[model samples]
Target: MAEIPANSLRFHVQRLPGHGAGPAVVFLHGLVVDNLSSFYCTLAVPVARAGHEAVLYDLRGHGRTERPRTGYDPGTAVRDLAALLAALRLDGHPVHLIGNSYGGTLALHAALARPDLVAGLVLIEPPLGGDWVANMIDTLSVAALGLEDGTLHSELTTLRRRKAARLAATADALLNRTSLIDDIAASRPFTPEDYGRLETPVLAVFGEHSELLPGARELARHAPHATVRILPGLGHDVLQGGTEALRHAVLERLGAVAAV
Candidate 1:
């Protein structure tokens, strides 16, 4: 795990250098309880093998990154990504961004903020509209309540579920002890108009059964040149379960972008 100073915080960054002169591909993981390991295990290696430098990092307050009290909003997250790219000296280069869930939201914002820096995008199951933050807060609050009631703890202990226990504990701390919920609630979401104006080539991949499929369809409908793919027999966890298909789609898009 490598650390770098970005956005006034130390970020956990990992880089896999590629063989040839291909574009740099950055992988952004989902929010809370997710880390670069997900991408590191799935797409990062394959991307590197495809002759593209693969960069993966833990977002603020996730994985091995510094867990600050505030600055968890999309705007701040976009800034952190920009700062990370600059710190890595990838500012002027047209890099491709592959973001999962909330990470996809940040990628969209980053491309909007600095189109010159982003060449293409791959968004997997990004929640675009609705009260996603509120829903997340409600879910976390319920989990925290369960933790306090000893229900979750007792179940985990009885089942010897070490991983589940650790993840639940982490989620409890992040939701109850920090300003993550507040920051997410206060953040602004992009409008349909915003999506329609994006000039960069975007590949939006969503599971056929995912609730966010509507949002993905909307993005494709609005965005000038966006491609949407629906993977069958999958759900919201497409990044984990549909790695082979996602990898193929991403590499295909990267190849298309490189050809242009």
Candidate 2:
């Protein structure tokens, strides 16, 4: 539980030091109810144990990171990552980014926006360009309206689900009070052309049942260095439901990076 100041915010980060010779790995979490803890408990430790430095930090307005009322778009997110790496003196060497859901999209943007800092990418169930941006905004907007009165938080609290209650409160504050939804709505989600320009190695994994699986196939089709893997009988929750397979996929990606 270390706090690092970067990009005008204090970010909660867990840096698992590794005995590797070079190249570090950073874990980016999904939007809303997710925090760095998701990866801290999963791939972070595994990556660190595999002898690669692993850095896991909560994104802006999520987890223990300071929440601002603005700057919730993909561009700001990518800048935050750049600033964080610079603050940690990790900008000297290219690092691998392992992102889940919205985090994966952010990682892709990072590679496109600042290729000098990224060595490779592991995107898990990322919702690529197109209707996903609108769908996400609509879902958040509806949840904001439903949570505006705080009934959901209160009910969760009354049910003794402290964790759920806390998460609901977090979501409420971010949705109703911040500019997140508006920023997302204004985003130009990644297109095939955007993917085509990315030369960094990418390993995108999706669940067979996930509606976003098409995004992985599209990425593979566009990015010359991209590979797609689909796990059957799973959906958008590959980070959780498909943990073991996901772990193997992550390690394999790291191995490939180390080999090259």
Candidate 3:
């Protein structure tokens, strides 16, 4: 893990160099309780093996990244991504973005905010426009904040032990201390016009049983260049056992990007 300063914060980053000269493929994991490790153990290595530089970083306030009390909005997230890419000199070229869960939300917002930095997008179970965004945000916030009862760490310590206890603590800090939840609630959701105006090619994957399936469909219907795929027997956690499928989707998207 590398520690880099970008957007005035120190972020934990991991990079896997690829064999080919194709555009880099950056992976972004979900919110609280998630860090670069999720992709580091799964897609990052595979993407690098497939000859695309894979960049993974801990989002602000998560993992080893410096956690501040404010600046948790979508705009701040996009700025962090932009600044990180620029700090690494990866901003000189367009890169493919593969984002899971809330990270996918950042990817979408980033592409909209800085189209020049993005080549394509691979969104796994993205929370799309409308009430989907509202509900997703509510669900995640409630789930995480529910741990603030102070019993969560003990419960996890009893089950999965120290590791789970640590995760619970992280969740506790993020939900109880930071302005993350309020920022998310106040942030703007993607409108139909946002998708209709989007020109970036997108490959959005959703599990057959995932509640995010509707959002993927809505994205496909509005985005001029978008494809939606439904993987059977999966849910919000597509990166868990669905790594192979997600890998194929990412590689296939890269191929399409290369052909362009």
RMSD of each candidate? 1.9, 0.9, 1.6
lDDT of 3 at 129: 59
Query: For model 3, how big is the CA root-mean-square deviation?
Result: 1.6
Q: Which 10-residue window in model 3 sums to the lowest lDDT?
A: 128-137
Candidate 2 Cα errors over 4 Å, as ranges? none
Model 1's lDDT to the true fold?
A: 0.86
Tens-place lDDT digits, model 1, residues 1-260:
69999999999999999986867999999877888999986899999999999999999988888888888888888899889999999887889999999899889988898888899999999888756667766876676666665567568867999888777766666776778888877767668899988979999999989988777877888999899999999999899889999999999999999999
lDDT of 2 by residue, 80-126 (tens): 99999999999999999999999999999999999999999999999
TM-score of 2: 0.98
Q: Per-prediction count of colliding residue pairs?
A: 0, 0, 0
Superior candidate under TM-score, 1 versus 2: 2
The runs of at least 3 residues in candidate 1 whose Cα sits more than 4 Å from the true structure, single-residue gaps closed, are: 148-160
**All candidates in order of TM-score, best leading:** 2, 3, 1
Would you estimate the TM-scores of all the predictions? Answer: 0.93, 0.98, 0.95
Instruction: Give lDDT: candidate 3, residue 2.
Output: 90
